[model samples]
Each structure stands twice: as C-alpha cells, then as structure tokens.
Target: MRKILVLSVSAGAGHVRAAQALVAAATGLHDVEVVHCDVLDFVPAAFRKLYAELYLDLVGRHPHLWAYLYDKADRAPREAWFSRMRRAVERLNTRALHEEVARQGADAIVCTHFLPAELLARRIAHGEAVPPVWVQVTDYDVHRLWVQPGMRGYLVAGDETAFRLRELLPDTPRIAVTGIPVLPPFAQRHDRAACAAELGIDPQRTTVLVMTGGAGIGSGAAMVERLLAIDGDFQIVALAGRNEALLAAYHRLAAAQPQRLWPLGFTTTVERVMACADIAVTKPGGLSISECLAVGLPMVLIAPIPGQEERNASHLLEQGAALLALDATALEYRIRRLLADPALRAGLRQRCLAIRRPAAARQALDQVLDADAAR
Candidate 1:
C-alpha cells in the first residue's frame, strides 16, 4: 500500500476540512494509507495558538484592517526580507515538522494549506528528497503566501485560480483545475421534507439556511434579525459553529420565535441540515461555498471577509450562482426576492449545479496516486 500524507494548518477550518475530505476519498482505496494532520498540532503551544487563532482575531475584530494586512502581505515577494524572516520564524517553531516528514516516508504528500507546503518545499530545495508534494489551493483566489518552491503539482478551485497559481509558480510540473474538495455527504442527495421534519421545522414553509461560519465569524445576530424582518412565510436555520455565545444568542432568538428561528450548533453533519433548506445565506468561505455548490443550493453571500472571500463572492456572482448582500437592507431584499421568484431560484440552482464538481476529492486523490505510480 502506498502511504499518502495529507497535511493542513488550522489557521481556518477550511484548510483542515479540505484535507479531511481528501482523506475521506483516499481511505476508500485499500492500497493507499492516508495520514491526516494539522501542522499546528506539531508546533509549540504558543506558536500554535498564535498561528491558528490570530487570523480569526484579526478577521473578527478588525476586518478592514485585516483586509489591508491581507493585501500588504500578498504584495511582498517570496524572497524579500520580511518574507525570509517569516519563513525563518516558521522554521524555528516547526523543527519537529522536519522530523515528522522524515519519519512518514510516504509515496506522496498533499497539503491543503500553504504553511506546511512552504516548509516541505524548502526541504525539497535543500536536497532532502521529500516525497512528491501537491499543494491544493482552498479558495478561488491564490495569495502570494501559497507560492512555494519545489512543489510537484498544484490543485486549484478553477481555471482562473489555476492561472493565478501558474503566474505565481511558473515552473510547477502540473496544475490541475480541481474544485475545492468537500465532504462526500455534500455530493449526496437527501429528502428535503424528511430533513426538515427531522429538524422539527415545517416542511411546507420556505426555508433559509444562514451559516454563521465554522468559527462563528459572520454578520451574526443583526443579520439574522434582518432576515427575520423580511415579510414572507419563511423560516431561518442559524448555524453557530463553535461559538457557545452565538449558540446562546440563537437559542434566545428561538425561544422568542420558536417556529421561525431554529438554532444549530457546531456539527459534522452539516449536509443533512443543508438539505432542510431552500437557500443559503453565508459569508462565502471557500469550503462553505463549495458545499453549497455541490448541493446545488442557491446562495446569498453576506459580509465576506475581504481578500479571498471577496474574490470568492465575485467568482460566484460572475458565474450567476449566487447573490451578494452587503448589509441588512440588501440581505432582506435578496431573501424576499428569492422567495418571490421561482424562476430566479431555479436559474441560480442551475448555475450552482453547473459549477459544482462533487467528485473533486476522488478525482484529486486518483490523480495523485496515478502520478505516484508513474514515478
């Protein structure tokens, strides 16, 4: 059996989720041994905490500032002074990752996040004979941070993203325009009425699923309130991902309007919940977007975190798969519009299905294994 190491960083849940999806596909092959890990798991506690949580802190507390920082970081050349310093610091904190890579001795390595890819690429450049590494871009956009040396291949969300990757890493051996890999469940079908009944919701009513991001990062309570204000026979499912406080807030809202507001906490089975809804109102995180697309669910994106997410919104909009809601007024207007127009809803759904590649995980795994076999 050929062993495949799937690595990610927990800077955001998307990267780790993408890695898990790949592992899910790889596990079906009896001849492949898949090892999944978060690079942060092997680092010192403080560094891990800072590396993992800092992005959330910045995006949540100061999004505009985060956008500025995101653009600033993207502008720096990989070989520049600060870029070298950041890489040096990452190396210092992840001494054990080098050891871990040496120990794995796998036929192939896959990284859904850029951090480990950076380290692994450096090792290959230094003549460490690291296994062939493939880096998958988790978003529709590719930031400069994802440009790493010595990678064997690049997997990206679309042809546009693949073009971006090519511009950044011109000498890469291969670039595959694979959609972001999502869990198998997203690609599977579910009974809408049965799912709604299971969630204690009225199956006949129009349903709107509002995704408070996996990390509880979205336009939060205010957005929920705006959706509620729309005059329609509709209900909302609010997903408050690991945020206990948000869950509490959701529960309180449900208490006052139990029939209309349904609160959902963090869950591994989001696909089932998604089946219960007619449309999704989300922040347009890459994984969330991919899941919606896979399910052929229409989307109304609200308050995308600037940079990659902003680009993701633009991509969906250009593809005619989703609508962008900037604030409470736009949010209310869009939901109301979707509810009123079946033709519009059908059009959006068709567009979503048109862009979805539900078998991305399996396809990506097959390609990697085929390449490994060739070598």
Candidate 2:
C-alpha cells in the first residue's frame, strides 16, 4: 500500500474541507492509505491561535485592509521581501512536519493550502528525497504564495484559472483544470419535495438557502433580516457554521417566524438544504460556490473576503451563475428579483449546470494517484 499525506491548514474552513473531500475520494481507491494533517498543529499553540484569530479579524472586521494586502502580495515577485519573510516564518513548523511525514513514510504529499506546498517545495529544492508533491489551489485565483517551481502537480478550479497559472509558472508541468473538490453529497441528486418535507419547509414556497461559509464570519444575521423584509412568498434557511452566537440569534428569530425561517448550525445536511432551495445567498468561497453549482443553485453573493473570494465572485458573475450584492439593500433587491422571475432563475440555473463538476474530487484523486504511478 502507498501512504499519501494530505496537508492542510485551518486558517479558513475551505482548505480543510478540500483536504477532507480529497481524503474521501482517495479512500475508495485501492492500495492507498490516506493520512490527514493540519499544518498549524505543528506550530506552537499560541501562534496557531493567533494565526486563526488574525485571519478572522482581517476578513470580518477589516476586509479592506486584507484586500490591500492581497493586491500588494499578488503584484509582488516570488522572491520579494514579503515572500521571503513569510517563508521564513513558515520554516519554523517544517521540522515537525518533516518528522510526521517521515514517521508515516508518506509516498505522496498533497497540499490543499499554500503553506505546506511551499515547505515541501523547499524540501525538494534542498535535495531531500521528498515524495511527489501535488498542490491543489483552493481558490479561483492563484496568488503568488502558491507558486513554486518544483511542484510535481497542480490542480486548479477551471481552465481560466489554469490559463492564469500557466502564465504565472510558464515552465511548470502537470497543471490540471479540475474543479475544487466538494463532498460527494453535493454531487449526488436529491429529491426537492422529499428534502423540503424532511426539513418541514413548505414545499410550495420558494426557498432561499443562506450560507456564509464554515466560519459564519459574514453579516449573516443582518443578511437574514434583510432577506425577511423582502416581499416574497419565500422561506429562508440560514446556516450559521460554528458561530454559536449567530446560531442562537437565528434560532430565536426562527421561533418568532415559525415556518418561514429555518436556522441551522454547522450541518452535514447542507446538500439536502441546497436541494430544497431555489436560490442561495452566500459568500463566494470556492468550495461553497462549487457545491452550489453542483446542485444547480443560483446565488446572490454577499461580502466575499477581499482576495480569493472577490475573484470567485467575479468568475461566477462572468459565468452568469451568480449576482453580487454589495449591501443589505442590494441583497434584498437581488433576492426579490430572482424570486419574482422564474425565467431569470432558470437562466442562472442553466449557467450553473454548464459549469458544475460534481466529480471533481474523484477526478483530482485519479490524477494525483496516476501521477504517483508514473513517477
């Protein structure tokens, strides 16, 4: 059996979720032992906590600053001072990671986030006999942080992203345009009426599913309030992931509204909820967008994080699968408009259908394993 180590970080839920999806896919293949590790776990506990807290603060409280930093980094060269500093900091955790990989005898290393990719690339550069390294880009845009010359394989969200990556790494080989891997549930078909009945939602009413990614870090409560104010015969299902306060608030709101509002905490049944909904109001994280598209759900994107999420929003808008709402008023307007017009909803659904790749995880797994075989 071949041991495969999948490295991810929990700075945001997307990277970890992507790693989980890949693990699920890999488990079904023969002769593969998948080991999952969070790179942050190797760092000091204080640093890990601070890293997560800082990410949340930047995205939730100071998005504009995050955007500025993102743009600055994007424009900077790979060997820039900031890049070097970031890599130097990352090196602190490398010894622990190297020990873990050596202990597992990992024959292949897959990275869903850039930090591990960089560390592994550095290992290969230093003449270490590191196994084949496969880096999966977890966002619609490829930042300079993810580019490394010696990576064995690159898995991207789509051809447009692939084109951009090729431009960034002209001589890099094995770039595959695989969509971001989502859980198998997202790919499977669900009965809308059955799901609605199961969730106790009115089958006849138009359903709007709202998500703000796994951290639940956006203006979810405010968005829900705006959505409720919109004049339409619709039901709202708000998923507040890991945000206990937000979940409690929504639960209280749901109590007052009864059947009209359905509040959920972090759930494994998001696919079922998506099946029951006609539209989704969400933040455009790559995994969320990919799952929504897999289910052919049109989207009203609100307040995506400055860098990758912004790029994801642009791509979905360009594909005609989603509409961006800059504020509460715009979100209300977009929701109302889509609910009132079946033609518009159908058009957006068709666009989503055009781009959906339900088997992305499986596809990515096959390619990664095949690359290992060839090596």
Candidate 3:
C-alpha cells in the first residue's frame, strides 16, 4: 500500500474540510493509506491555543485588516523569516512527522493549506528528502505565496485560477486546474423535499440556510434577532459552526419563534443542508460558495472578508448567480426580494447550475495520479 500524508491547519474550518474531502476521495482508490495531521496540533498547547484565539480575533474583529494582512503577506517576497519560524516549530513536529513518513514510506504529500505546504517545501529545500509535495489551493482566487518553488504538484480550484497562477508564476510546471476538491456527498443527489421533511421543515415555504462560517465569526445573534424581527414566515435554518455558545443563545432566542427558526451547531451534514435549501445566506468563503453551487443553492452573500472574499462575491454577482447584501438589514431585504420573484430566482438558479462543478474532487485525484505517474 502506498501512503499519502494530508496536511491541514485549524485556522479555519474550510482548510480542514478541503483536506478531509481529498483524503476521502483518495482513500477509495486502491493501495492508499491516508494519514491526516493537524499542523497546529504538533505545536505547544499554549502556543496552539494562542494562535487559534488570535486568528479568530483578527478575522472576527477586523476582517478588513486581516484581508490586508493576507494581501500584504502574499506580496512580500519569500524570505527566510517564515522558513526560520517553521524550523522553530519543526522541533515540535518534525520528529513525529518524520517517523510517520518513514514508517508509512509516504509516496506523496498533499497540503490543502499554505502553512503546511510552506513548511514541507522548506523542509525539502533544507534537504529533508520528503516525498512529493502537492499544494492544493483551497480558495477561488490563487495567492502567489502558495507557489512554493520546488512543489511536485499544484492543484487549483478551477481553470481560471490555474491560469491566473501561471501568469503570476510562470515557472511552476506542475500546476493543474482540478476544481475545488469537494467531497462526494456534495456531489450526490438527495431527495430535497425528503431531506426537508426529515429536518422538520415545511416543503412549501422556501428554506434559507444561514451560515456564520466555521467559528461563527459574525454577530449571528444580531442577525437572527433581526431576521426574526422582520415578521416573515419563511423557514430559516441558522448554522453556527462549532459555536456552542452561539447555538445555545440562538436556542433561547428561538424559543418564541420555533416554527420559523432552526439552529444547528457543529455538524457533518452541511452538504445535505445545502442540498435541501432553496437559498443560502452566507459569507463568501470560497469553499462554502463552491459547495452551495454544487448543491444548486443560490446564495445571498453577506459579510464576506475584504480581499479575496470581496473578489469572490463580485465574481458571483457578475455571473448573476448571487445576490449581494451588506449586513443584516440588507440581508433580510435581499432574502425577501430573492424569494418573492420567481423569474429572478429561476435566472439566478440557472446561472448557478452553469457554474456548478461536481467532478472537482475526482478530477483533483486524477491530477495527483498523473503527477505520480509522471514521476
């Protein structure tokens, strides 16, 4: 059996999710033993906790500033600074990872997030002799920083993103457009009405799935309160991902509005929810947007982060597939507007269908195979 190492970070849910999907897809193929590792999990507990808290705080309290930092980080020339930082953490992670790699004798290394890809590439550059490192771009817009010089493969979300990366870094020969690497669950067909009935939702009323990203970054409490205040009768499902406090708070707030409000905490069935939803109210995280498209859920985009998400929102809007809303008030109004006009909804739905890429994961797996075959 060939071994494959899937490296990911817990900075946000999307990166971890993308890695999980790739592992799932890769495992079904013969003779592959997939090992999953959380990059931060290897670090000191205090530093790990501090990193997670700081990441959430920065993105939640200052999205624009975080976006600016991402852009700035991408623009800065690759230096020994991050390489040295990785080396510092290497003392914590290197022994365990090296043992696992040597024990499994890994044939390939897959990275869904830049942190691990960066670290692995630096290790290889330092003559660590690790296996082939494949960097999978998890977002719609490709960042220049993801293009590590000696990477064995680069799997991007789409041809446009792949082309863009090629333009930015002309020397990376392993680049391939493999879509976004969504799992088969999102690709599978479910009986939408049946799924709705199972979830205790009214099939007649339009179901809107509202998400606050992985850590519940936004004021979901305020958003749900404002939505309830609108006096609408539509079925609303609010997903507070891994936010037990937010979920409990919503449960209390929803006490008076059980018929229209449905709150869920961390769940593995988001693809099913998206499949059953008529529309989705969400931040424009590329993974979420791509999953929505896969499930044919038109999006009412709200509170996207400033740089790449802003670009993603604009792309959806320009494609006539999503309705953009600035905040809670706008979100409520846009939801009503989208639900009210059948013609508009149909138009947007068709556009979403046009953009849906169901074969992304399989295609990405093929690219991994091709790269391996080439070697």
In model 3, how large is the Cα lDDT of residue 162?
Answer: 78
| Candidate 2 lDDT, 231-297, residue by residue in tens | 7678998888788988988888888788789988887888998999999988899888998999999
Worst 10 residues of 2 by lDDT: 213-222
Give the winner by TM-score: 1 or 2: 1
Residue 273 shift from truth in candidate 2, angstroms: 1.0
TM-score: model 1 vs. ground truth: 0.96
lDDT, residue 93, model 2:
49
RMSD for each model, in Å, please?
1.8, 1.9, 2.6
Query: Which run of 10 residues does model 3 get worst, by summed lDDT?
Result: 212-221
Superior candidate under lDDT, 1 versus 2 = 1
After TM-score superposition, the amount by which residue 275's alpha carbon in candidate 1 deviates from its true location, in angstroms, is: 0.9
Q: Which ten residues in a row have the lowest lDDT in candidate 1?
A: 212-221
lDDT of 1 by residue, 170-240 (tens): 67578888789998889999998888887899888888998864222334776687677777788999998
